[model samples]
Every structure is written in C-alpha cells, then in structure tokens.
Target: MSASLICELCPKSCRIPEGEAGDCRVRVNVGGKLRATTYGRPSAVHVDPIEKKPLFHFLPGTGTFSIATAGCNLHCKFCQNWELSQRDGTEMEVRYQADPPKVVAGALQTGCRSIAYTYSDPVVFYEYTFDTARLAREKGLKNVLVTAGYITPGPLRRLCKVVDASNTDLKYFDDGAYRRYSDATLKPVLDALVIQKEEGVWLEVTNLVVPTLNDDMEMIRKMCRWMVKHLGPDTPLHFSRFFPMYKLQNLPPTPVETLLRAREEGLAAGLRYVYVGNLHGGAEENTRCPSCGKDAVRRVGFQVLEMGVRDGRCRSCGGKIAGRWGA
Candidate 1:
C-alpha cells in the first residue's frame, strides 16, 4: 500500500491517500504523487473589467483576462462563488483546454491590460497561475491575484515574484470566527498578506462584513490597526457588504450601515485609503486623496467615469496615490 502524502501548499496540510483527492477536491493523489488535475483546464474564463476584481487602485479603466479552476482550499460558509470554488476537477460543466501559453495569448488578443487569477482562490491552481503569470509578464501583461490569502509562506513568496498586484480577503480578525465561518484559521492568512506585501506585490485588502459574524466594530478596529502598523497605512482597505450566500443563506444581508462603519473604522485607524464595496452608487467607490481630500478616481459600478490621477498622483493636489495607474 502507498503511504499518504501531505499537500504543503496551504495551511490545511491535507494528507491524501492514493487515488483520493485532498480537501480542495481538485488535487488528487495518484500513483504516490499529488497532481493538480485542473491545471491547464480552466473551468471559468472571461474578460472582465479590472474594477470588477474590485482592484480600484490598480490599472483602473481596463479589462482583465480572468480565469479560475475548480476547488478552493478554504470552504467559506458564505462563499459568493461557491459553485465555481466548491467543486472538483471533473465536476465542472465546462473546462476550457487553454494552457499557459494560450492563456497569455488570449489576454493579448482580448486587449486585456492584465491577467487575473480570480473567482476561485488561485492558490489551489498554483502551478497554472505561476506559469501563466510568468509568461504574461514577459509579454508585458500585468498579473493580478484575487485570493483569500490562505497560502503557505514559501509557495506564496515565490508566487509573489510573478504577481503584480493582489486583492486578498482578510476574512476575520478572530481565529474562532475564521474557523466557524470559513473552516480556516486566521494566522496563515495574515502571514500570507504580510508575505505578499514584503515581496513587493501591490496588495489591497478586502473585508467582507458579515452581520453578527465579523462585524464587531472593535474587531474591525483591531484589523485596521494591524494593517496600518504591519502592511502600512497607505494600503487600500475595502470593507465589502456581504449577502447571505451558500451555507449562510439564513443570515440576513449585511446592513449598509455596518459597511459604512467598517470603512470609518478603517480610515480612522490610520489607513490612508478606505473604500466600501458590494453596496452601489456611493462616494466610497471613488478613491480620494489623503492629503487634499480631493477625488482621485471616480467610478460608478465597475465603470471608470473619471480619473483625477496623473502620473500615479492626485491631479488636484499632486498627492501620491498608491496604485499601478498604467502609463
């Protein structure tokens, strides 16, 4: 009998016996080797606006070639993309046979300013993301990661080399809340965020404020304070309104008041850039200059209506904005 091998990609450290898949469902143990079965076969592929990734500060007013394979390391109870993220390799209805080279070509052909490893956590498709990102970078296309930030340090530090920017979800400050809500712990995610920042990746943070779960003002304050001290105050922080999703359908949608308060908490805690997401048609969607308090970038629901930034600085006051405003 073959011995079980450990998958060291994520904090889960799943032990898989031969012929069986790991906790993510897509990675399988075959012939004593762990294989990413979904690699080179993206189940979901699309050309989406960069703002849709909610990466407001990075490459605004541009499209991104987005791709995701089946399965995610963490099984979040309130996962919005559960269908795409909670399945196995074979369970996907449509798997595009686009290899790493083809994915890079598609980005160029589609006029995408960047390639986004998104929807499902890209950590599960590590090899595919790294390969595609390396090729995309050579072709002058930026690479973005929309992740939950639950990855191991060694692999994450390596992945950051090719990745240009990331919007990592900091789900909860409380470890117990992470376990109950996402079946994951908090420390690894925090570590991953720090690693990404330390690796010089343009990092943005998203906090999905679920009512009665991770919406405590005190906890939000702690997270914001940590971000300011550890990740720097200029880091963009997004407080997103959460709707009842997947296993959390019984829970009511997050009140707009909560999201607003969370944004306030983030900004008050020395964070230079704070925005509210998921709720539409508000000033929070715009990026304001920290010094002049003038509008830097204006948006209306994924559409870039106006840009008050010039040469990566606020045109109104010439204040430096922390974003990769493409030249």
Candidate 2:
C-alpha cells in the first residue's frame, strides 16, 4: 500500500491518503506523491472587463482574460460562485483542456490587457496560474490575481514575481468570525496580503459585508486601520454588499446603507481610495483622488465613462494615484 502524505501548499496543511485529495479537491496524492491534477485543465475561461475583477485601480477600462480551475482552499459559507469554486476538477461540466500557452494566446487574441486567475482561488491552481502568468508577462500582458489571500508566504512570494496586481478578499476582521464562516484562520490571510505588498504586487482589498456577521462598523474600522498601517493609505479598499447564497441563504442581502457605511469607515480610517462594489450607477463607484478630492476615474458598473487620471496620477492636481495604468 502507498503511504499517505501531507499537502503543504496552503495554510490548511491537509493530509491526504494515497488515493485521496486535499481539502481543495484538486491536489491528489498518488503513489505517495502530491500532484496538482487540474494544472492544465481549466473549467472556466472568459474575456472580462478588468473592472469585473472589481479591480478599480489597476488598468481600469480594459479587458482582462479570466480563467480558473475547479478548486478552492477556503470553504466560505456565502460563496457567490459556489457552483464553480466548491467543486473538484472531475465534477466540472465545462472543463477546458487549454494549456498555459493556449491561455495566453486566447488573451492576446481577445485583446485583453491582462489575464486574471480568478473565480476560484488561484492558490489552489498555483502551477497553472504561475506558468500562464509568466508567459503572459513575456508577451506584454499583465496578470491579476483575485484571491482569498489564504495561502502560505513562500508560494505567495513566488507568485508575486510574475503577478502584477491582486484583489484579495479580506472576508472579516475578527478571527473568530473568519473561522466560524470561512473554515479558515485569519493570520495566514493577513500575512499573505503583506507578502504581496512587499513583493511589489499592486494590492487592493475587498470586504464582503455579510449582515450581522461581519458588517459591524467597528470591525470595518479595524480592518481599514490595519490596511492603512501595513498596506499604506493608497491601497484601494472595496466594500462589497453580500447577497444571500450558498450555505448562508438564511441571512438577508447586505443593505446598501451598510455598504456605504463600510466605505465611509474605510475612508475615515485614512484609506486614500475606497469603493462600494456590486451596486451600479453610484457615486461611490468612482475613484476619487485623495489629494484633490476629484473623481479621478468614473465608472458605472464595469463600464468606464471617463478617465480623469493620466500616467497613474490625478490630472487635476498631479497627485500620485497608485495603479498600473500605462501601456
């Protein structure tokens, strides 16, 4: 009989028997070797607006070719893309056999400015994302990571070499709330975010305010304060309004007022750029300059209506706005 082994990719450090997979359901132990089974097999691929990655700062008003395999490290109770994230590679109905080269080619053909390793967590599909991002970088395309930030620093540091930007889901400020709702710990995610920042990866943070769970203004204040202290005031913070889904359907959708409140808290805590997401056609969707208080970039949902910034600086006052905004 083959011996069992542990997968040390994520903070979970799941132990898998010879015939079994890790908690992510993609890393399988075969003959005592851990293999990323879905390395080249992607389950979802699309040419999406960079804004749809909810990346308001990096390369706004551009197309991003997004891809994902079928696995995730964290099992968040209110996953919006649960059907895709909460499944293994074998369970996907639309698995694509596209290799790294094919994925990069698709992005170029689609006229995308960047490639997004999103939908599911990229940590679970590390090899695929890393390979594709490397190739994409050589071809002059940027790489974006939409992740939960629940990864080990070693892997995250390596990934930051090829990746250009990230929209890390912060989830909650309280450690107890993180464990209770997401089956994950808090410190690892926080550490991952700091590593990304230190690696020169353009970082943006998103918080999905679940009603009565993590929507407390005090917790939001703490999260913003932490970001300002560690990630700097220029780091963009997105407050997302959660809709009832997956295992947390018993909870009501987050009120718009609550999202607005969270945004205010983040800004009040000294964050330079704060946005309210998942709600369209609002003033909070615009990127306001911290120095001049001008709307640096205006957007309605995924559509960019105006660009008031040039060369990553505010046009009105020439204040430095943080992002990768050039060709």
- RMSD per candidate (Å) reads 0.9, 0.9
lDDT of 1 by residue, 1-327 (tens): 888999999999999999999899988899999999999999999999998888988889999999999999999999999999999979888999999999999999999999999999999999999999999999999999999999899999999999999999999999999998798999999999999999999999999999889999999999999999999998999888888899999999899888888889988999988988888899999998988998888888889899999889899888898888984
- Model 1 steric clash pairs: none
Cα lDDT computed for each candidate against the true fold: 0.93, 0.92
Highest lDDT: which candidate? 1
> Where in model 1 is the C-alpha error above 4 Å?
none
For candidate 2, what is the total of clashing residue pairs? 0
Model 2 scores worst on lDDT over the 10 consecutive residues at 318-327
Give the alpha carbon lDDT tens digit for every residue of 1-327 in model 2: 788898878999998999899999999998889888899999999999999888988888889999999999999999999999999999999888999999999999999999999999999999999999999999999999999999888888999999999999999998998899899999999999999999999999889989999988988999999999999998998898889999999999889999998888988899988999899899999999878988989999999999998998899999988887875
